[model samples]
Structure formats: C-alpha cells, structure tokens
Target: MRSIVIIGGGIAGAATALAAAKAGLSPVVFEAHPASGEDIGAFLTLAPNGFAALRELGVADAVAAAAFPMTELSVLARTGEVVASRPTSDSFTLRRAELCRVLQTEAIGRGIPLHHGKRLVTVREDEDGVTAEFADGESVRGDLLVGADGLRSAVRGLLDDSVVPRYAGQRVFYGHTAKAAPSEPGRMVMVRGSSVAFGYTVSPARETYWFGRTHGDELSPAEMAAPGWRDHLVELLRDDATPAAEIVAATAEPLLVTNTWDLPAVPRWRTGRVVLVGDAAHAASPATGQGASMAVEDAIVLAKALRDTANPLEVYERLRRPRAEANVAASARMTAGATDTVPRVGSARRPADGAVERMLAWDAVLED
Candidate 1:
C-alpha cells in the first residue's frame, strides 16, 4: 500500500509528488506535456499560505529563490484615484514555468520518477489497488491514484462525466512589458477600471507583469492564441485614466488570453482507491488569486491525511472541501462584480486559533 500513481505533471502534480515522498510514500508523476516548461508566459503570485505549505513539503526555499517579493498592493478607482493601499507580507511572484521547473526538479532530486509525454487514458480499480493506463500504451499499478490534472482533467471526466469546467463570465489577459510604469520596487497596483479589472507589478528584472479581466464572450482556442489581444485590451482600458492602457500598449510580447473557468463544487472528490486534488477537485476563478496557493495547500493536507489515516481519501476531502469551496465562492463573487470590496486572497474559513497554521506544520501530527 505504498506505491502511489500521480496524474498530471503541473503544479499540483509535482507538488503532490513532493508531499507524498516527504510522507514516506513511493510516488511517480506522469505529465502529458513533453517537458516541464509549458505555459512559460503566464505568471502568478504565491501568498504566504502557499509558502507555508511549501515549507511543509521542504521546498519553500527552492521555490522562493526563483521568485521576487511583492511587498504591497494598492487599489485604484477608474479615475486613477487611490482607494486603498496595504502591505502584502510574504508574497512572491514568479513565472508559472519557473514554479513548475522548481517543483519538478525538487521531486526528481528526491528520487520521484517523473515521466513526461505520458497522458492518462483510463483507470481500472480492483479490490487490491488501482491500475492506470496511459495513452502511450504504458500502465502502472499503485495502491492509491491521485488526480491533479487540472481544470479540464481527464481523471475528473473519467470519474464522472457530468463534472466539467464552466466559464466564470470573463476573459482574462496576461502580458509583459519592458516599459516601466509608476510602480514601486515591490508594489502591485490594481485598477478597477470602467470595464476591466486590471493589475500590474514590476519584477526585479524591470519587466512589468500585468493582467486584465473583462466581461465578454468566451474565446475560441484560435482567438486565444491570436496576436491581437494586446490592442483589444488596450481599447478596453482606453477610457480609464489608469496606467493599464499604457502598460498594455507597451507590451511587445504576444499577449496571453483565456476564458476564466471554475468549478463551484465537485459532487464527488474520491472513490475507493482514487482521489482528486488541486484544480481537478476544486478550481476557482483567478479573481481572488488563490488558485496556486490553494493547490499547494491541498498537496500538504492530502499528504498529511495519507500519512495519518486509514481512510485517507475521505479524511482529506473532509478537511479540504470547506476551505477550497470558500475560495471558489469568493472568486465567483468577485468575478461577477457582486462585491465592491477589494479582492482578498485568503478570505476563506481561516480560523483565528491557528488551525490552518497547524495543518501546514510538517512536524504536527494529523488527526483523522
């Protein structure tokens, strides 16, 4: 009952492999991509809770070394007037590719075999264990199977065809520019423009990372990969007096665009020897910026559950559902423009008695 099979080599999969290894379980990763550096253009900020989880997995320092700090966040109105300014302690920003490479490298260093280009095709479970068949005609047997594939997960579809990712009513665009704005060394600026929610931060290397969300029709894959999103986004921000328009106009790199998607709830998270984690189980919109953070937290908790309990899947779902769903609901609210308050990353069921802190503590024993 020690061998574990992990599907998907994204952030969730790699992180989970590390967590499982740390918990004394034998785990291997199967990634659909040919390499670890897909989605290199996109970037995200990892909150403190994410770092807490990474610390538990013994990879925080490695991950942090590839990221730059984000010390403050400032919110602005459409008129470019400052609405709120607050410090965001212990937050770091880095490319999505860098994060994946760091985690995968760490997992390989720990002797966890990661097989790329192995796409999961089907799963068969017996009374003893589960066997996963890949598209490349390879198969592996393990005592437990974990699905960390992501929003459009093959495992989720196989588990229950009804569970699918839905659009969250907005199209998000991300871009980078060498042209500097009026940004501080470690401050992120968010502008609530007339038709777009925009945010930008300057990296230590003087590149500006910015993203904008606009209410619009869902884009086709061809449209998303097209080269005109920068001009379209600039036009959307033209009316606002904020720096969003100028920053976007200065971007020379191809702008990345995609429809925002989320799963408010997954009717079932597990069955027998199979369980889901990260976006595969509960994916939230990017409105709250907690997707990666919540995913890392999932890895830590799921590993702890496996380490401490007989019913690892049930125990892991029981401990994780509430917080993960809270993030989904909050992100939905923000994406729908249902709230006027500034979006917060961790507005979930975080108790004041240090419960979440304890949950991520590697030395702390988990009680089922």
Candidate 2:
C-alpha cells in the first residue's frame, strides 16, 4: 500500500486525506496549528462544485449541516438600484474554522491519523520515497508527499523558487453584526459602492456576515492593528445611498482586514515524490469565491489520478493546472475591477457543468 504524507490540515489537506483514504492509500495529516479552529475570523462560500466534490468524498451532508444555505445573489448600484440578481447553484456559507473542523472530524472518524503542531521544516525526496521533518523534531517517511499548506507553502518552495504570492490589488475586510439592515433569508446582497465592493448574507440565526474590498496599498501591520477600522469603512460607504454604511456602523466587533494575495502561476507543482495541491499550487483572489471549491476539486482529482495511473504526479498536473490557473486569471481581473459584475456567490459561471460534474463523479474512471 502506498503511504501519503500530507502537510497542512486546512480544507485542502483534510479533504485530500479523506479522498486518498477512499482510494485505498494510507494518508496522514500534519497541521501547523496546535488544534482546530485557528482561523475563524473569515468565512467563505462553498459552491455547488465544492459540495459535489465533498459528496464524492462522502462528507457533503456533514458540511451542509454546519453551513447556511444561500440561494440568490443580488447586486445593487451606488444609488441603491438593483442592477442584477441571479439564483446561485447550491451555495452555502460557513466560517473558515467551521469548515476546517467539519473536514477534520470527518477525517478523524475515518481513522486517518492527524497530527497537530507538526509544522514541516524540511523535505527530503529520493527515488524510493520521501521524508518530512517537522518543527517538533519528528520525521515521517511516505511513498508520496502532498503539500496543501496554502499560499505560503514550504513545499512549493522545494518544487520551484520562482513562484511567490503577490497582492491582488485590494484590501479585504470582514465583519458580522445582528443590528444590520433587515435581510431576506437565503439571499446574499452585493453593494457596488462608489469606492468599495461590499457583500453580506444573513445566517439562519439572523446574524449578518459581510465583507468589503477596496483597491489600495496594502495596510501596514501598525495600521491593521490600530482600532477605528469600522469608522474608516463606514466613511467609505457614507456617500453611497445603500445599506452598507448602516451595516458597518452597527458592527460591534473589531473588523478583520487583510491584503488579498494570490499566485498568478507556478513554474512547477511536483518534484520527485513531492506534489502541491490547493492554494499551495494555484491561489486565487477572494473576488472569484472559488478558492475552497477549487481546493476540493483538486483533492478529488488528485486521488483519482493516483489510483488510476502509474505516473500520478505528471497526469495530475496535466488535468488540474489548466482549470486552476484559469481561476487565478479570472480572479485577478475581478480584483482589478475589470468587470462590472460581481462574481456570483458560487462561481463566475457554473463551473460544475456537465464535463466538470463528470470529472468530480467518483464512480467515473479517470482517463490517463
């Protein structure tokens, strides 16, 4: 049996572990954080494509139970005019931490060994197998090593030094509030303000989850740590006659803001027995909202490749690189404000069309 060593215990890593196990491979997960629920500040939408991938992995229902459904996406202009509204294709919103917890739980229940605080420090690869050395002075050897360690991936560096994360030309802010403007359940609203792009959705419990993005220089550490971000965001929305200002003003918690970052392209995704997955390979800006979904897709496709082919790494890259890099390009355009339409909640378009759906279908045999 082939043994897989996976780095990073976030969505991509955990999902990969499950998929690999289903493919009859022995997989172990190493997480940098001490425990689950480390990054709960930000939330994301899992599109139909992502859920479809989870279904293939046999965890869709578990994820759905922890998420709030979003059925429609409505866009408003600066003058508060309804510009566009469309139905989303089976989209659900959940906090990042919640999604990670759900995936970890599902992985654990399946008896996959997941080690926390095992930050990888070095990777050694050879013709026979590969070894991963963690920060805690423990090391493990496996037939293959998968890096789902995200944008700042240590594994990616071992593959190619040219690929580095770049700013996507925007500063993103996230906040939640119960006192915001009344919203219809199952609907996500996007406000195209004069200066900022804002979106919000009310949870089943009636708490509003909202995010705003503005194109500017990246915030310094001092500016990000300083208070009064709520006031700053409210001021940016003051001139627009929309609910964004009121929603932001009513936010009681300190808003979390960070510079949007992505990798436009990677020169290499695999070297020897080590391969990259998810954001470690192809990261897109949040403007497209397909990061998590794309990661899930990667998980499924990778396991299929490994199960069906002798040269799994080469075949996996050929199958995944095109779609993943396209998403990166699309997100770059959206973050640069090149398009007027806010990418709908699920995908820029229904990426889960017939071909993609067939690709994600677990029973379908992968073609070499």
Candidate 3:
C-alpha cells in the first residue's frame, strides 16, 4: 500500500484523505487546529459540481443531511431590483463547521488517522519519497505529499516562491442568524452595487447564512464585536434596493470580518512526488462562490490520477492545471463584476461555463 501524507485538515485535506483511502492509499492527515472543526464562520454553498465530487467520495448523503439545497440564484441591483436569475440544479447551504464534521466523520470511519495540532513547517521531496517536517521538529515520510494547507501553504512556498496570495481590495463580513418561521428554500441571492454587495442562502434548519463585502482596507475588530453589528449591517444593506434590511435584521451572534484574498495562478502544481491541491494550488476569490466546490473537485480528480498512473505527479498536473486555471480566471472575472465601480444594467454571467461542466461530469474512481 502506498503511504500518502496530507497537510492541513480543511475541507480539501479531509476530502483528499478520504479519496486516497478509497484509492487503496492510507493517508495521514495533519491539522493545525487542535479540534476537528473550529469556528471558521458560517455556511458555504456546495454547488452541483462540488456536490458531484462529494458524492463520488461517498459523503454526499451525510453532507446533504446537514445542508439545504439551493435551487436558484438571484442577482439584484444595489437599489434592490432583481437584475438576473440563474437556475441552480443542485446546491446546498450548510454551516462550514457542519460540513467539516461530516467530512471528518467519513474520513475517520475509513480509518484515516488525523493528527490535530500538527502545524506543517517544511516539506522536502526526493527520489525515494516525500518528507514533511512539523513545527515541533517532528517529521513523517510518505510515498506522496499533498499540500491542502490552504492559501498560505508551506508546501507551496517550498515548491514555488512566485506563487503569492493577493488581496482582492475588499473586506467581507460573514455570519449566520436564526431565521423566524416560514423560511423558503431556494437559490442564493446576491445584492450587487457599486460599493457594496450582500449574498445569502437559507439553510434547511431555517437559519440564514449571509455575507457582505465592501471596498475597504480593513474592518476594526471593535466593529466586528459591536453589539449593534446587525444594525450596522442593516445600514450597509440599505445600499441595496432589495430586502437586505430584512435579512440583516434577522441575523444573530458572532459576526466575523476578514480581508478577502486569492493566490495568483502558478505555472505548475507539482514538484517531484510533492503536489499541491485546493487553495494551495489555486486559491479563488469568494466572489465566484466556488472555492469549496473546486477544492472538493480537486480531491476527486487528484486521487484518480494518482491511483491510475505510475508518474502520479505528471498525471495530476495534466488533469488539474486546466481546471484550476479556469476556476482562477473565472474568480477574477466574477470579482470584477461583483465589485464593479460602475453600476451595471444586467446580471453578470460567470466566465467560462464549459469549464465548470467538465469538472462536474467526471466519473472515474481511482484504484491501485
């Protein structure tokens, strides 16, 4: 059996471990956080493409149980007028912690050992195998090394110094609120404007998960901790013509503010037996709403490639590069539309439609 070491226990890393296990490679996962699922903010949308990948990994049902399916996406002008709408065939809105719990459960059930609190400091690859050095001066060796360590990946830094995460020039506030009775299940709604935008989806349990993005260098920690954050959120939503005020008013505790950033595309994602996956390879901006989906997709495709080929690194690059590039480019374009300085008349279309479909349609399962 091939030994695989995956750094980072985020969605991407967890998914990769599960996929690798199914591919006959027992993987050890290293997570920096001591606990399995930490408070990392609110819900995320797993679109059809991402959902398909999760289904392949055999965790779709568990994830679906915790998710509310999204059926439509509405784009609104800053003044609140609906500008464009798209039909989403299959998507789900679930808390990020809930989703992580599902993935972690699935991974553990498969006998994948997870080492929490192991922060990766360095990774070295040789002809024999790859070795990962931890911050505590411990080390582990494996047949392959996968960097799913998120945007600021230590693996990425070792492989390519040129790859860097760039700020998108916008700060985002994210949180979830308990919904009042009579919540409708449907598509995610985006309220777009010249200076600000709000997007949300209602979870199955009648909780509203929403996010607001604005042009700002940073948000004060005090602003995030204010008891009246909801009120300030309502003021921001007033920029939108739609019912943003209503949604903002419905929100509750633990509002989080973070600067949005994305990594520019790297020329390659592989260095010998070492490879990068998910955000480490191609971090996309949240404007595209495909980060989680893309990461799931990466795990599926990468496992397939590695299991089927002797030169896993080459195969992994060939299969992942084009798809990751498409997503990275699409994210940049989507960010431009969402944060357009000039108000546009119509809803902005996602860039490179065929690219997303191709990723979703793959059906191969790797076996050694």
The top-ranked prediction according to lDDT is 2
The C-alpha TM-scores of every prediction are: 0.97, 0.96, 0.87
lDDT score for residue 365 of model 3: 38
Instruction: Please state every model's RMSD to the true fold in angstroms.
Output: 1.5, 1.6, 3.9
Query: How much is 226 displaced in model 1, in angstroms?
Result: 2.7
Q: Candidate 3: minimum summed lDDT over ten consecutive residues — where?
A: 341-350
Please write out the lDDT profile of model 3 over residues 1-368, one tens digit for every residue.
28989998989999999888877887999998889767468567776777877888889999998777787777777766777876776677777878888998889898999999898888877889889999889999998889998998888888888787887667777877776323356657777655567777666666677787777664566755667666776886665566667777776655777777787667768877788899999887777667787788788777777777676667667767776777677666666564532212121233475544443333543323
**Runs off by more than 4 Å, candidate 2:** 338-341, 348-353
Q: Give candidate 3's whole-model lDDT.
A: 0.75
What stretches of model 3 exceed 4 Å from their correct place?
181-183, 218-231, 338-368
Error of 1 at 347 (Å): 6.8
Q: What C-alpha root-mean-square deviation, in Å, does candidate 3 show against the real structure?
A: 3.9
lDDT of 2 by residue, 54-122 (tens): 889999999999998888889999898988898876788999999999999999999999999898899
lDDT of each model, Cα atoms only? 0.87, 0.88, 0.75
